[model samples]
Target: MTIDDHKSHLVTLGKFLKQFQVTGSKKDEEIPGNDRFFEDFDQKIDNAIHYNGWFTRENIIFALQQWSEALTPQNLKWWLGDYNLNQSGGKTVGIVMAGNIPLVGFHDFISVLVSNHKVLVKQSSHDKQLLPVIAAYLMNLDSRYENRIEFTKGKLEDFDAVIATGSDNTARYFEYYFKGKPSIIRKNRNSVAIITGNETKEELAKLGEDIFRYYGLGCRNVSKLYIPKDYNFDNFFQAIYEWNPIINREKYANNYDYNKAVYLMSEFKLLDNGFLMLKEDKNFGSPIATLFYEIYSDETELEKNLEEHSEKIQCVVKLHPGKKEVKFGHTQKPQLWDYADNIDTIDFLSIL
Candidate 1:
């Protein structure tokens, strides 16, 4: 299929996804092939929740909504506009996906296909349900997509290049295994929010979305906080109280109970709000129900320190007026052009 054909299929897929939202699923008959695919796709969402405890219906719908917004004609054009994708055919790209969040490997999947390359995906066991349904929808849109998308059960063989996401440990294996091929090996990276004392309650509340969304499973979720020394957290706690319902989830509550007990038994000082724990840690990756934080005396020094550890961070959350730092609550809503790990997927594919 040509690039425009791919774009049109994706735009239709986005329209299908737009029907499923956090509030409710409202079918729009205007989308092509909806009659054949809509009911099955709705059922698959429930099947996904049944398969993965972490994949709540709300989180899955949120992911769908984000993708729906991203796949618009305008967004897709802007994302691929700068690249000369005409040179981007005749390769099979293997993707080793991470199952931490819903459709986490989708960006890479679409990147390869939109660049006119075939994709071989080895899905994480935790999240194997949804994408194939999507692939089917795309294939229904155009029979050509059937030739472009493939899922592997054994190993990612017979591929020219690869993109893999995993822990820091698995990265070594990916590097060693794919050494002969052009690849993007992604390691563990966490996001952090810089809490200036001046942020309004509204902004801090928005920051709560950054923390609690996906039950803190996504790398884009802010796991660490950089706050001013002697900063009072009373307002911050109050602002985030809207998400207190998150603790009601059994898995999250269990983690909270386990981690809280471990912290108390160890005599580590903590700030507790019944649901979430705040620990004064210099690390970026925190546990499921806990948030790590450190105090910064100067913004300049803090920026330098973060830059020094840039590889450890996925993205920075801050409320600077003119600076391009990610705003509060928008970490999970990254634009289509916001390439993960600052690596340009299209650029990588176009050259290959």
Candidate 2:
């Protein structure tokens, strides 16, 4: 099919989103996954075995807007230079996804799709329910595409190009298993933020979602806060406390207990209100909803160290110093225009 042929299909999917009520109303169900997406948005997002848990209607709105901004026609043209269906390209690919986070695998999934390649996917059992629901709607837009993508249970060995996401440990398995194919192997990663003294209450609340939502089980969640030695914990703690209603959980007990134990072992020097955990550590990442802090006397010195780990950092959470978004959240809660891996993902998709 020609670019002209596929362009309308994309538009149709966006329209079907509203027709079917998939993602959200901010953009209308016309887009794609608008209502169901929002249904999942307001529904309980925590599926312990599946990190894809934790998203709100607002989160979906933010993400949808960002995606729309980044996928403009001119930008798509500039990004996807030559890959065309008319040229009868290579066999394209398949993706064995990760359930560690919500649609974390969509980047490569769409990349292969936009490249006009056949994507045979082995959906994580946890996500078996989501992508399929989305596909059912997409199929409504174009039956031609319905058969083009699939959800299966199998090994990644059958594909020409494969991308797999898993823990850092599973990377060795992915490397040896898919060694001969055109592939990208992604492993575990976590995001962090720099908490300047000037953040607003709104920013603090959003940051709380970034850190505590999904119980800190995703790579994009801010696991650590960069602060000056003189920083006071009141505003941060107060903001979190305001939303204390979010902590009513059977699963949160494990993290609460563990963090409490760690604190108790340290002589309870750290007083937590049973919401977020705080401790001293050099690492920007932490386990669960716990946050690690490295109180630096000098912000300049702290930033230099962070630069060394730039590859590990996802979002800065704030602009200069005064007022901006204030804080950041997990990658699960991205704005539509936000780039993934700090790279213009849509542009990258165009080139592939």
Candidate 3:
């Protein structure tokens, strides 16, 4: 199939996804082939949540909505406008996905296919249900995708290049295993927010979304805070109070309780709000329901330190600091062009 054909199929799939939302699911008459997919779509959403505790209904719906917004014809055209897909010796690309959040590796899956390459996906066991169902929908939209898409539960073989996401430890294994082939092996990274003490309450409230969304499971979620020294957290606490309902979830509550007890037993000073805990830590990867914080005396030095350790950072959230940074609350909502790890997947596939 041509590139236009692939784009058309994906646009149709996007319309199908738009039918389901957090508020409710509706059948769109304009989207053809929904008769076969609509019923199964509902079941897959349920199965995804049942299989993964982090895949709450709200989170699943948010992921679907993001995909739906991203897969539009205009968006696809714009995102792929500069790439040349005319040279058509496509290779099979293998993907080892991460299950930290729902559909986390979907961008890689689509990038390979959109670049005219076949995709062999080894999904995380925690997120096995959702992507295959969407792949089936794409196949139904066009039978050509059936030959282009694949899933494997066992060892991955017979692929030219590979993309794998995992912790730093697994990255060593991926690097050793795929040393002979071209690959993109991702390691653990975390996002952090820089608080200037002058942010409006509305902005801080939105920052709350960046911190707590997906129950703070995704890489893009802000796990650390860089605040001004002697900054009072009363305003921050009051701003994030709306998300108190998150504590009601059993898994998150269990983590809060367990982590709190551990900190108390160790005599670590902590700021607790019944649901969330804030601790003075220099590490970026904070535990679930807990946020690590460090005080910064100077913004210039902080920027220099962050630049020196750029590899450990996934994204830097800031408010109008004049440099390229993700706006508040937009950490999780990456656009089609926002390649993870600052590595261009489309460019990688195009050259292959």
Candidate 4:
């Protein structure tokens, strides 16, 4: 595939998604009245949409917009050019998808598509539906990509470059297993929000979506919070409260029970919000739902502290203005122009 091929594939995918939303299912509702394919997902679609404590459309929109806009070769080339590279020839890439979030593996999909390469995608069981929908749309738009993108459920050792996203433990396996291969082995990460004295209720609510969405299973989910000394927890709690009605009560209660069992009796120092838990001392790209945070005093120190946790901190959410940080809540969404892991992914791929 070529850069032009990349554009063709994405535009097709977007249109198909729109169609799926319209006719697919009511629960799968797309951008109001534009498409109808959502009628297909049936009730499962409803649950996916209304499934509390996971992802919200705002963040997904944030991600999808970037994904959609980055479809063109100009955007792809512009992104690659920043790192002084451009797509040259085709390649075969093995991508192991992480099903933590709805479409977490899509980034690798973009990388593979834009770099004039063939993607050997190993779909996750948790998200079997999405990739097919995406592939269907892309294929509908251009037949050329119908065979280029495939769903594989196997291990690969032949690809030129490899990208794998999984838990810290799984990453260890990937590293030792895939050793000597040019790879990007992403470990677990969690998003955290730094409360810098300027957040409003609206922003806080959005942050709630970032935290609770996908049952806090997503790598981009915020598992920690950093606040100034003696900060009012009430304001933060109140904002999160607006989402209380939607919180998966059973899941919340389960996590609450687990934490209380460990903390109240076991003498664990777990910071909790009655729905979530917080604990310190870890190094992974993610944290579990029952536990989510570490308290910090000055954010500047935490910011510096973040360098140490770089391998595991996915996105951080902050309502503090003028901050271009990789803080909490910003995990799922990324600008095409942004270089992840301090390296230009597209740029690097283009050179290969």
Candidate 5:
């Protein structure tokens, strides 16, 4: 199939996803084959939550809505505008997706197919349901996709290049295993926000969404804070009070209680707001229900330190646009062109 054919199918898939949202599921009669897929999809959403406690209904809908907004004709065109897709007899690209958040590795999945290469997908066990169902819907839209997309439960073989996302340890394994082939092996990275003691209350509230969305499981979630020396956190705590109900969830509350106990036993100082804890630390990857923080004395020195540790950071949120910085509230709402880890997946696949 041609690239235009691929684009059309993805557009249809996006429209299909739009029907299912947190408020309600509205079936659009204009979408073809909805009658066959919608019922099964409704069940899959339920199954997704049952299979993984973190996959709540609201988070699933949010992920679907983001993809629905991203797969538009204009967005796809803009994202792939500079790529050459005319290569014949393309190789198979193996993708090992991460399940930290729902549909986390979908960009890689779509990138391979849109670049006219066949994809061999090895989905993370934590996220086993959603993508396969969507893949079936795509095949129903165009039989050509059936020949191009394949999912594996066993070892991945017969692939020219590989893209794998995992922890720092698994990344070492991937690098050693796929050393002979062109590969992109990703490791653990966390996001952080820089507070200059000047952000508006509304911006900080939105920043709370960056911290609490998907229960802060995704790599895009801001797990750390960079604040000026002696900066008061009263405004930040007040702005994020709305998300306090997150503690009602069993898993999150357990983590909060356990981490708080550990800190108390160790005699470490903590700032607690009942649901979340803020601790002074130098690390980026904080545990659930906790956020690590550090005080900065100078902006120039802070920038230099952050740049020095850029490899360990995924995103840096700030009020103003700076180098590799995202807006306060926009970390979770990434655009279609927002490549993960600053690596261009489409560009990587096009050359392979």
Candidate 6:
């Protein structure tokens, strides 16, 4: 398929995805193949939630809504506007997708195909159900996609290059295994927010969304906070109370109980609000149901510290839009251009 053909099919897929939203699923009769695929896709969402407890309905729908917004014709045009993909394709790129959140690996899946390269996907067992359903929809949209996309439960072979996302440990294995081939092996990275104590309650509420979305499973979720030395927890806790219902979820509640127990047994001080726990920690990657925090003495030094450890962070949330900093709650709503690990996947594929 030509680039425009790819764009057209993806735009159609976007429209189909738009039907399933956080508010509710609404089928649009005008969208092609809705009669055939929409119901199956809806069922797959439930299957995904059952297969992996982390894949909640709200989070899955949220992911779909974000992708629907991203895959528009205009967004596709802008995403590819600068690349010269005319003579660049037919290579097979293997992708090892992480199962941290719903549809987490989808961007890479579309990146390889949209750039004209064939894709061989090895999905995490935890997130195996949903993407295949999406792949089937794409294949139905155009038969050409059938030849371009393939999924495997076994080892990946016969691909020219690879893109793998995993923890720091698995990344080492990927690096050693794919050492000779062109690859993007991603390691663990966490997002953190910088609270200056002047944030409005509205902004803090939005920040709560960043913290609570996906049950804090995504790398983009704010796992840590960089707060001013004298920052109080009252405003922050009150602002995020809207998400207190998250505590009722068994998996999250269990984590909260376990982690809180461990901390209390160790006599570590923490601020708890029944659902979320905040501890004074210098680490960026906090445990589930807990957010790590550190008091910053100087804003300039804090920025410099974040800069020095940039590789360890996926995003830095703050009010200001400095280098590599995102707004209060937009970390999870990254645009099509927001490449993970600051590595440009499109550019990587274009060169290949």
Determine which window of 10 residues in candidate 6 has minimal summed lDDT.
320-329
Candidate 3 lDDT score at position 220: 90
Residue pairs with backbone atoms closer than 3 Å in model 3 (clashes)? none
lDDT of 4 at 198: 68
TM-scores across all candidates? 0.98, 0.76, 0.97, 0.78, 0.98, 0.98
- Score candidate 1 by lDDT: 0.92
What TM-score number comes out for model 6?
Answer: 0.98
Query: Where does the lowest 10-residue lDDT sum fall in candidate 4?
Result: 19-28
lDDT of 6 by residue, 1-352 (tens): 7999999999999999999976778999999899898898999888999999877889899899999999998999999999999988999999999998988999999999988999999999889888998898899889988999999989899999999999999999999988899999999999999999998888899999899999998899999999887888898998899999899999999999999999999999999999999999988999999999999999999989998999999999998768668998799899889999999999999989
Clashes of each: 0, 27, 0, 40, 0, 0
Greater lDDT among 3 and 6 belongs to: 6
Question: In angstroms, how far off is 36's CA in candidate 2?
Answer: 13
lDDT of 1 by residue, 1-352 (tens): 7778888999989999999977778989899888998899989999999989999999999999999999999998898888898877899999999999999999999999999999999999889999999999999999988899999998889999999999999999999999999999999999999998999888899999999999999999999999998999999999999999999999999999999999999999999998999999998999999999999999999989988999898889987623447988899999988888989989999999
| lDDT scores of the candidates, listed in order | 0.92, 0.60, 0.91, 0.61, 0.91, 0.92
lDDT of 2 by residue, 1-352 (tens): 4565555555454343333223433435345555455455333333322443444334333433434444455545554555444543345476778765445566566566665667788887655544655555556556767767877786644567676777778889989988877666666666767777887776676677777655666677778877876888888898777657556655666667776887688784564667767777776667665678877677678667767877677655553432322335434545434444555533433434
Candidate 3 shows a clash count of: 0
**Stronger candidate by lDDT (1 vs 5):** 1
Candidate 5 Cα misplacement greater than 4 A, ranges? none
The digit string of per-residue lDDT tens for model 4 on 74-131 reads 6655655544225354677788887656667787787777666777888766655556
